[model samples]
Target: MPGNPALTEATYYILLSLHKPRHGYGIMQQTEELSGGRVRLAAGTLYGALNTLCDKGWIVLKTVDEDNRRKEYQLTDKGREILINEVKRLKELARNGEMILGEEL
Candidate 1:
């Protein structure tokens, strides 16, 4: 565990998108697809989040293609652990809610 707080929906999706190496546009598209089109990341937002994640050591620049001007990023091992923890936390939240509502979770 990284002792991280709960992840925002955008951060969660962004981290999830980096399960494989992907460039900025690929990340954006994959995030939207993963969220069922509910999370369309603007260019500024995407880049900003990418930089922040990089700073946090959750993701790293995996490759840079100078000719095509592409930079690909991938999750660090720490990032994977964070993602897994987030999944567990989310499941616990849903389970608690379902218990209160007396519904299957």
Candidate 2:
């Protein structure tokens, strides 16, 4: 799968939150918790990110409630690949930063 170099921080967390299936609100809560409350995504921002991820084939609708009000999404195989690649890239970045700063992080 071709990787997206332009994936934003919000996009990364949003995708990561879907490692299991989750609805929009669930995603928001998990993202905040993951970031220690430093990355709270508003509903609109999250919905927009979800739409973009869906269009990119990175996430898919996994389930819907009987009332059709809650929909859960999960990562596709391609999404997992992308997430792994992003992790690698982030590690490289951290390594480089540590090297330049002369400190371990």
Candidate 3:
């Protein structure tokens, strides 16, 4: 099991993108769209993160296209749990910030 330490922005988005099965390019596009273009994953970075996520059992290979040499990945149950937890953590952070800042800062 991976620890609950904060996920890097890239890793977080990568996991989010895998909620539906997607190929590397699809993941890249979806991630950029999801982040409003704030995050653009390069090929090497995307593949590396995909490998890591697979090693962690957070994402799994959903399908492979032998003709086109493309692969699609989707989130595992554990991956969804992790993502949900991350959302909860983010919400808590936002709530605390709003409470403290109070439109002043």
Q: Which structure among the candidates has the greatest lDDT?
A: 1
Model 2 over residues 1-105: C-alpha lDDT tens digits? 465485688988998999989999999999999999999999998888899889989999866776776789999999999898899889888888989986545
TM-score, cand. 3 vs. native = 0.91
lDDT of each: 0.90, 0.88, 0.89
Candidate 1: tens digits of C-alpha lDDT, residues 1-105: 555589988889989999988999998999999988999988998899999999999999966778877789999999999999999999998888988987544
Give me candidate 1's TM-score against the actual structure: 0.89
lDDT of 3: 0.89
Best by TM-score: 3
Q: Give the Cα-based TM-score of candidate 2 against the true structure.
A: 0.88
Which sections of candidate 3 miss by over 4 Å? 1-3
Model 2 regions lying over 4 Å from their true place: 1-6
Ranking by TM-score: 3, 1, 2
lDDT of 3 at 36: 92
Clashing pairs in 1: none
Clashing pairs in 2: none
TM-score of each: 0.89, 0.88, 0.91
